[model samples]
Target chain A: MLKKDPNFTRLKKLGGRGYLGRVSYWLGVDHLLVVEVTNYNERYRRFYFRDLQAVIVQRNRNRMWGNIVAGVIAILPALGALALLSDGEYAGASLVGGILVLIGIFILSNTLRGPMCSVHLRTAVQTQKLANIDRWRRAEFLIETLTPLIQSLQVSAGEAQSPNPATVSNPPAASAVQPDFS
Target chain B: MSTASNNVLNCPNCGKSLSDLPEMLPAVERCPACERQTRVVVFPAFSRPVVKGATAEAVMMEGEATCFYHAKKRAQVPCDECGRFLCAVCDLEVNGRHLCPQCLETGAKKGKVQSLERGRFRWDQVISTLLVLPLISCGFLLPLTSLAALVLVVWKWKSPPSLVHNTRLSLIVCGVLALIEFIGGCAFWWFMLFGSRRY
Candidate 1:
């Protein structure tokens, strides 16, 4: 878990450029400083996993609020009918009352459709966030675990940076040493 | 790392990766892949891990509804009409009142619950009025049948009043039609009885 990540500070400072900027750029913004920050990029794209997770979480939280609002809108027609019916005492009360009840049920069914759709969308986004996080975590683990090996390679290659013909004379000893592992 | 894979070249101006490292940095000490005394920037990756079910916390965070009448714990039963959260004891049965106990009581007191007090007028009343109105205008010696239908329609239409005002107009038209029927019937009867006397 301990990492000497230089870009961590940069990522934290830059934040996950919100969806607005990304969308604006995609919509052909002329002044867009377009940069390809793929999830494959270990620096700039680090926050994407968390951003996706936040989106899913936010959507799920909105579900209950949306459901309550939809439930309220469903019954508005019944209120309207009652107001209209209050005009006459009873000569048409039974008929209007029956119609209002039926209309209320219909409206309730209609309102439920919206929350149901949102619930489905939220569930889908939640699943996508979980999957993306899992992929990013695995890739990050591999890249971090290999950091020492990569640094050692860098050191050896740095010594060989100068391509001198004199240093190239030892090609035979390097080739013969590979057969002595046993 | 030496085969161009480990290190990345960072632009001096913006610190972003410069793919054309040799072109951007002329005095580059090491190859683009190696970070030895090179202008290549090695930026490390940072990850913040979140558990899969983290969003479930948000689901729990949404506020719960409170009962309208009891105002005790959370309420789940939304009123079909007003959308108010009403407890079992508070729920009203009327079509639109769908109220808490307090509102239900108020509605009952105001007689808004059974909006039916204004007498439901049927089409049959107008039909009956039309059938019987003629008897009243013709001065029919016998006033049992048609006269009764007209009287019932008028009284019902007039007393409680119809929810639809058209029912009153319908009764008036029917009454006129019934009167014509009654006058025609009496005139025929008088003609037959007097024609025999003239013969």
Candidate 2:
């Protein structure tokens, strides 16, 4: 077993659905940005913080019509049972209505679930989706955390390429002397 | 190059030696020589040299088991697959099973173990076959088989995908075909009953 690093602090945990999604949360990050995706099998990818260009979140809209149709189908049996109850079939009406109610509840729970989103972490080399973040809220949070960190790293890298402040300060003295000439 | 061989830590920004700095992993520590901040992440495994156990000695003594691969080397463990005596170097541990090179190669070639596989059977293919085969054969049980195929696709929708990537194209095709079959079957039954009453 690989030992956990004490220095590593989990900023946030993005919950995903299914077994592969559950397994991704437990994988160790060893000094590299690891994006793991699991469906039937697990796939792992690593990225350097310096190489990360962007983190994107794309929202996926749920189809309301599909849910509505499913709900209608589920309630049809109960509607039929109500008509039978009016004709004095109490026992049959109660059993059929009870079953349809349970099925309707199941369909309603699925319909009421929040929208899912895809999270993509892009580099110059390749763009990869982080499968563990399925919900839109979690994808937004991850983007918020990573975008700044990458930007800061890029800022530092940019600063390194420019001339040092100590060496460039003497050249600016010439600009200050132009004010005296004016 | 010599400093790298000696494992001397250096500042990435200024290329200044940071051997004297206090060891702190995953933390920004200021380099004393360069006055620059450097983020260091150290893995403990890299700090020490790996120790390999001594190789099996020669089988000079009587009744001592010898390695099948190397006759001069004494056997430490038997191969789990073929029961061949193996030296420490020849023993390969895979999924807790001690296998020789021959068995490992054969197992990989035959696809007996799923460990090396990257792809899997697609459920969509199964559904597609179930829906289309009955229709192609003009079987009387086409309606029932198509219904079963649709039920399977719906039931396994949220199930973990197989090794193959699932586009759900097959599921849609199967569903459409199944729905058509169901509608035709229902219409046929209605016509038979109502038309016969008219006759």
Candidate 3:
């Protein structure tokens, strides 16, 4: 429901704090529905369930952080090897150090490249939950607005269909001619 | 809104039209014209889609009528080799394909399975320790501190159960570097301090 709103488009375009602010606002709405409602079994299915697209976006964003960290790790080995080469005395120690540093850098780089969807899946689920809460709120508003119209229809129908006036009158002899109010 | 009857279904006994009957009521109901209870049954009654079959325990049969696994108590999956019944739990997803439990067991015992052991290690710490170890022998305190750093890196690398290869590599590198640093430092001290005095 939040995604459908034009305001979301504007917020997304704004970027920076605006994007983060919109996401947090939607998250708050989702949190409210999760906490307040007790009977909506379909809420999770309709709103909070993780879809594939959302999962992919989340993973892509998360991997950027891992990549940056890996890049930083890669720097260490290069720097260490350079330092060891400059110090000619500890040649044996330097070789072992160089190998270990290089291996660590390789592992970090490999892990950064590998496929990881856990982070993305988690964020998608959260977003879906927020959307479900927004849908529930709209459904409640419709019900509240329509209830009075239904009651009016019931009253009008009752007035039109009453038993014949001649049979089983309210008072035994009270006629239209007298119209007494005692 | 109301529409004209698409097809007139009349009661057999009274010939009274049954098309105007309420949608909520069963299609076959008593005809007032006959003053007796009668039914107007249709071949394809206007009921919701029948997702389950007549048995109700299994899904409605579709193209090719696959067998249902009574033991597993699920449906819609067929074995790869033989088109027999197999539920998802009983099905093995292998090498871009689905194989039944029997096939999976045979394949596993035949050593046709891939070992999934992707390990994690702190590459930064290992590299740092190794690099620092060689520098340790330049001064007595440098080697001591670098040895401590190497021990820490090895410990951290070995903590996780998955990444043994990466951890072992780092450990070996750090240990050898530390040993070399200690021995080289001792040799240098002996040559400078004692060799000159003896001469």
Q: Candidate 2 — which residues are off by over 4 angstroms?
A: A1-3, A7-13, A19-41, A63-66, A72-75, A87-113, A161-182, B1-199
- Model 2, span B1-199: residue lDDT tens: 0111122344544556544422332233444676543323332211222234456678889888988999888998999989999998788877678888898888866655544433333567677777767767866666677778779878877654542233365567767887887677656667777877987
List, for all models, the DockQ compared with the true complex.
0.01, 0.03, 0.02
The residue-by-residue lDDT of candidate 1 on A1-182, one tens digit each, is 00122222111111134332210011011110112222212111112211211111111223345546655764665565567677765645566567656655665554453221110001112322212111222223322332343334433543555334342322111000011111
Cα deviation at B75, candidate 2, in Å, is: 43
Highest-lDDT candidate: 2
Q: Least lDDT summed over 10 consecutive residues: which range in candidate 2 chain B?
A: B42-51
Q: Against the correct fold, how does model 3 do in TM-score? A: 0.23
> Each candidate's lDDT (Cα)?
0.36, 0.54, 0.38
Give the root-mean-square deviation of each candidate in angstroms.
Answer: 33.2, 19.1, 28.2
Candidate 1: stretches off by over 4 Å: A1-182, B1-145, B159-165
Candidate 3's docking class is incorrect
Between prediction 2 and prediction 3, the one with superior lDDT is: 2
Sort the predicted structures by DockQ, highest score first: 2, 3, 1
Residue A167 Cα positional deviation in candidate 1, in Å, after optimal superposition: 71
Candidate 1 local Cα displacement, residue A157, angstroms: 68
TM-score of 2: 0.35
